[model samples]
Target: MFLYFLTLVLMVMGLYCLIAKKNIVKKIIGIVIMEYSINLFLILIGYKKDGIAPILLKNVSVEELTSRGVDPLPQALVLTSIVIGLGTLALMVAICLRIYEKYKTFDMSKINKLKG
Candidate 1:
């Protein structure tokens, strides 16, 4: 669908940001964008038109549940991925801050030149 194509485009944009940017913060933002795009893709994979939540109600038959329920696995995976992404983002920002403290610049080329 168009959504999948959009997701791919978003990922490519993120990749471009990661590869083409010079600032450490911008690179970090690119990584976050890529992560978010992947999460969006996963969510799209599990989506169903006119689907209900996977939760079972007393009145719902097994057949009906199977026919209409959206998948829960991808949602769970996305939740876990979000937590992991947050941790990684924090770590990256901390490293960037330390690099700035040492080099006085967020520019990668400058940082490389200043490296002892």
Candidate 2:
């Protein structure tokens, strides 16, 4: 219950940062935070109370392996997600830098040229 609450809190905080912040850099940070929170939640979902590593030995039977090993799918998924997040963060930061170069400011409010 407590973990769920914490997850919700993290998600809400990220959303608040993304929505309320005026700086483009801060918005990118918020997006990164949101991605991390989602990855954490996904990893937590696959965790077992008392589980062993999912290494396979020659003598280990299939049933024993299934009973004692931790789930590997979530770890793999999280790794892929982290890679994707890194790519996205890099793109966002590049765009923010370009924006800063053009406007010489980080505040989005100052970038009012598109308003019509």
Candidate 3:
């Protein structure tokens, strides 16, 4: 519902920042936003209305667990994605720091001096 549109808007905002921002750090942040938005979208896609945790209890029927419980796969996938995102963010920051060391600036335009 509203959440889908919100996630889509967030994705677009992230894309805009990534493409239009001139600061390297801002671009990195945009990448993170985009990643998060995608993760949120995935979680929403796997959502079940009136869903409960996918836990098995002795009193609960297998059919109830199957029909009423939320899918655990997406949650697991999101966890993995978060870890991967962290690694990616760290790599991006490390690269940014190296670039800053070279140009003494975080501005992408200013770093163009290295083109020569």
Candidate 4:
């Protein structure tokens, strides 16, 4: 229950930063935080109190393996999500650099020439 509450708080804080902050860099940071929080939550879902690595040996029986091993699906999903997050973060940073080069300021309001 405590873990769930902490995860929820992390998620909310990340979302608040993403939605309320105007700086492009801060938004990128918020996005990264959100991604990490979600990854943490996913990992928590597959956690077992006494989990062991999921490996299948020739001598291992099906029932024994099922009862002792950790779930691999969430680990795979977290890897994919982390890769996607890195790609997005890179793109966001590149765009922010371009914006800075053009506008000479990190302030979002000052860069709002598109507002009409």
- Candidate 1 backbone collisions, by pair: none
lDDT (Cα, tens digit) per residue for candidate 4, span 41-98: 9998888778877898888787878998889899999999999999998899999999
Give me the runs in candidate 2 sitting further than 4 Å from their true place: 58-64
Model 3 per-residue lDDT tens digits across residues 1-116: 99999999999999999999999999999999999999999899789999989999898899999999998998999999999999999999999999999889999988774454
**Alpha-carbon lDDT, every model:** 0.95, 0.88, 0.94, 0.87
- Which regions in candidate 3 have their CA more than 4 angstroms from the true location? 113-116
How far residue 112's Cα lies from its native spot in candidate 3, in Å, is 1.4
Best by lDDT: 1
Clashing pairs in 4: none
At residue 65, what lDDT does model 4 achieve? Answer: 82
**What's the C-alpha lDDT at position 99 in model 1?**
94
Model with the higher TM-score, candidate 1 or 4:
1
lDDT of 2 by residue, 1-116 (tens): 67867877888889899999999888888888888889988888888767777888888777877998889999999999999999998899888889999999999999899865
Model 3 CA RMSD to the hidden true structure, in angstroms? 1.6
Tell me the tens digit of each residue's lDDT in model 1 across 45-75. Answer: 9999999989889998889899999999999
Estimate the Cα RMSD of every predicted model relative to the unseen true structure. Answer: 1.9, 1.7, 1.6, 1.7
